[model samples]
Target: MPDTRQPVAARRTHCPYCALQCGTRISGTRADAVTVEPADFPVNRGRLCQKGWTAPGLLAAPDRLAAPLVRGRSGRLLTATWDSALQAAAEGLARVRDAHGADALAVFGGGGLTNEKAYLLGKFARLALGTSNIDYNGRFCMSSAAAAGNAAFGLDRGLPFPVTDLSRARTVLLAGANVAETMPPLMQHLHQARLVVVDPRRSATAHRAALHLQPAPGTDLALALGMLHVVITEGRLDTAYIGRRTTGFEALAGRAAGWWPERTEAVTGVPAADLRTAVDLLTQSGDCYVLTGRGVEQHRQGTATAAAFINLALALGLPGTPSGGYGCLTGQGNGQGGREHGQKSDQLPGYRSLSDPADRAHVARVWRVPVGRLPGPGLRAYELLDALGEEQGPRALLVMGSNPVVSAPHAARITARLAALDFLVVADFVPSDTARLADVVLPVTQWAEEEGTMTNLEGRVLRRRALLDPPPPVRSDLHVLHGIAVRLGEPPEHYPTEPRKVFEELAAASEGGRADYSGITYDRLDAGESLFWPCPATPDPHPGTPRLFLDRFAHPDGRARFADVEHDGPAEDTGAAYPVHATTGRVLTHYQSGAQTRRVPELAAVAPEAFVEVHPDTAARSGLADGDLARVVSARGGMTARVRLDPTLRPDTVFVPFHFSGDGRANLFTHPALDPLSGMPEFKVSAVRLEPLPE
Candidate 1:
């Protein structure tokens, strides 16, 4: 930690990283030379992980894109002036719209983008390009949890209660969330709580827990069902809470009917004794919480699995209670806000659905356009990318703040589809792997160079202050959206170059809808009080909601709905040819895609390359040894990674971190079989065969 005994000379800001959004003080005269110290924010409470400590290096990365580039007739990217670059991008999109209809033009966004940028991207796609193809990277993050939460609780806020509330919990069932490595600072709150973790490998988080249940990959649904079965068999159900505050109990009980401990043990590979012990722990524990992460949310049955966890929490009557609740730890910095806005393929601002006539009329009225002008829902992220080169797929694609080539499932296919596009435009601060493939790459301002708001995992909207100015010709995303819309012959008054101005319009657009932010403003955020959403437009201003489902649910009848979900195995089953189950997750030192973190010399040094963790028996069976290079072959593609032996993991499973590109890329082996309800790709489970390389 940097010494803070000297006088404070930096501006307070939030980390430009994960959904934790830890607070920091940034000091720098130029982009390259900067300093950071932990800020006294409630979320992390003046603590930061290695990623946050070294985040300052991103501002000064030598390869940052400071000037726009356009591909010329020589098939090479050439430096272009701002006017020429914007004109080229607009012309390309316009050409696609004119030739193949508006649906042939598409826009993709990122969850790291500020709330304002995400909002404008959706509106620009609809009003400027007049296309229905608008979705973001969050479909890859927590869409399954969002879908399941909505179906079960009538609404979705990543964590309905504040992070500080975790201190009040006595016991927690942490599933598939390796917060110890992913969000280290959050571990401070868990030290006092009795934790029960479920993972294949002995994860850092699993090691710290009181009880660790090692289930097979893609068997989280079965594990949860087994626990529920124990709760029912032991007569530990909260019949009072269920009878009073929920419905569909009979259906849920019936779904978990056949999933006794023995049956669950057979499917999940977890011992029946361990399942019974976990159930007993959860039942006996007071003020308990059940939380999940991508491990459970990034599978083919992700939605059903998430529903199972929520059902477990509701059966214990944990929602809206202090320190005890169900939440899907959102992956990206603005993922919660990203999904709440209109950037989703089938959503409108304020989390309204595009399929609803009332929601369409409400948003159309706010945008000052006829309701009929708005297009219907388009394809989800994976489906949209898969359609890129097809006849009905988009011909020209505009991307912002995302690096899909390194992050999306089936990376080889996405790269090829991007290569086949007639036009590709990317607005990013760095020359990301995806940016290197663009026809036009526009230099854009990053976190400290731009002013906007971000909603954290708790659904708390916080302001991201600008601490320094960007170099000449480097523009903000708001500037790019406005410039492009104007060149497309859209009304000038419709697009605002200023973030606050755009947020003002956005607040009005969200006034009467769910996920309401009407009462929040820059002024209120600066008022030294923590605030959450559903703050309706008012002068007196009610405090933002930090808790949900206290008295009634968001649904009309004022009762939380229950999902009668059933369990299923993974999309791809292991066979003789591919006998090992491969799973992917993030390492402690890297963020998603590693676009920014990899640029930091220190962070890269900490996690320089990707490697696979294989159990001792599996390693021996495959002839792989510690520190040996292995080529992992899956149904879709293959990647070479170093293998390390782990005795703790399930003998049939292997683990890989999905950070690096090229030979170490993990997404190359992932399956795009989506949870139909949420459109989330199954990134957690894949069947593979390993081949060791000769020394």
Candidate 2:
């Protein structure tokens, strides 16, 4: 807990939205009466987006949950005392567990949770509930990139180098990332570099690019393969670096040989000349960076698409160099840290594999639990949701800090699944769409009312400071977890409510693993140390690793591996009935799910409702005009939104922001077909048709 005696004015903290985690300072004594100003921080450099500026609105949101609520006999959620709510929740979960065994209880977490809360939630699920079904929303965000990174580099960090290092690049190739709208402050680092953007629509980021390749949706993998093919045939490969620093070059080279530029252009709808130009821009400059975002990564072949781009970077000797590399621009506040600790189904704290004997032993010893007591790996996020209340599946679900009703792909199905659950518990600050359906809703502290750490997109571990106390009836997630664990018969000492103590246990648990954080202390962070991960405990004062793979990779042989990846298009194909491609993404004013951003008055005014972005020609062809209510219907489902015409979009593609709920919810049109390697759903591309709704 934060010291009450500490001054309440000018307390520094980080934004609650996005992985950039812009530094901010609050200048008031309470949540309802505070002002936010940008603070000097390396990542954002004192700048903030609209979401960051309006983050304080969440602390005093009109819909903020200040009391516990439990469903009564009539299925209406009524206000309940803390004791009654806890007991009801415990009994409900225990009832399901007793009837269907431990695996029948599942846990779902969020990427926005503080490191302390994320670690404890995983521990609580494994040790207290003895359940194997656990996963987080990050599976929908960057799991594909993580999978590709681990396969290629033997490690997975959003960016192995600091975000500032991007400023030194001469050319930058951005694939399916609209950073200008998604993360505005990042544009500052790319101002000096020539931008080459690839997308189906001309996004804010594309508007500023030196070149934009408007490929057909889900054809990003084909584009990348074509670029690699161009690089290989043109004899532009850095043979020396390839031979010295990586393996599997022969297999990758053989694969690339088949994806000639003309053949790729035929499949991707990108011109052969543009494919050659993209390859030239990437390889001609010795200092360049390749970055991918959700556009290319939310597909059935997402991992392969990510790997194809990595293969391009590796062949050009970009990664492991000072001014060049391949990295993923993570989406959430703690997306990097959330996955590092044990929130994923198959991972333990410190990114250790759950199936590895030695890794399991190390974490079990730190947790003070017998190694065999820890349950085995369980279902991924989509699978878990799909299995709700099914035979031999999870009968009860506990969701903390995430709203899957509005965020998950094929969301109508997910909502139905939640409704089918025997018991549901949701911990959130506001009554989000998912929380509205929970059997028990626990009011938990928000970013301004909690103290912990978050790892940013650069792999930089940052301190998240609390500026004000939570409302009297509200509790921190740590406390909620602690209370539930106690009810589950776990000793009080096992689940500490103090963030620092939980971090101490986390550090010890992560000591020898890949994402080691043993040497990082709150004192060190307070002392202004700019620490990155893999900071091991040492007798000598060790500078945290700001950059990785400078000399060697994390693999046993000290060399990166090149995956023999090839292009596999989207799971769904276009036809006469559903000819247009529909893709989903973020808007400048909204963050994930619109749970927090949609509640802000100022933000709501700027972008109050979701609208579809279609080319004028496409709209005209469909007999639709700007501001016309239209239904984008896919085979799975449909969502209705106002049409907004933009000539910059590809004539066959339309864009929708995924933040809105109700009729405007974009995920309704998305598919649950997942990337086999990463379990990431196909949120970006789907085949659909537009129908104008009668006014």
Q: lDDT values of the candidates?
A: 0.88, 0.91
TM-score of candidate 1 versus the correct structure, residues matched by position: 0.98
For model 2, residues 109-165, the per-residue Cα lDDT tens digits are: 999999999999999999889999999999999999999999889999999999999
TM, every model: 0.98, 0.98
Best candidate, lDDT: 2
Query: Model 1: per-residue lDDT, tens digit, 1-695?
Result: 11223333787889999998998998866623678899989889999999899887888788888699999999899999999999999999998889999999999999998889988898999889999998889999999999999988889999988888887778889998999999999998777888999888899999899899989899999888888888888898988888888888889898888999999989988899988888788778677889899998999899999999998888888776663789889989999888888899999888888999999998899899999889999989999998996888999999997889988999999999999998999999888988999999999997877898899999999999877778887999988988889999998889898989888888888888889998988888877667899888876887999988788877788777778888778999999999999999998999999988999999999888888999988998998889999988899998889888989888889999999988789989899899999899999999999999875
Q: Can you list the residue pairs that collide in candidate 1?
A: 32-60
Local error of candidate 1 at 439, Å? 0.6
Q: Which ranges of candidate 1 are over 4 A from the true structure?
A: 1-8
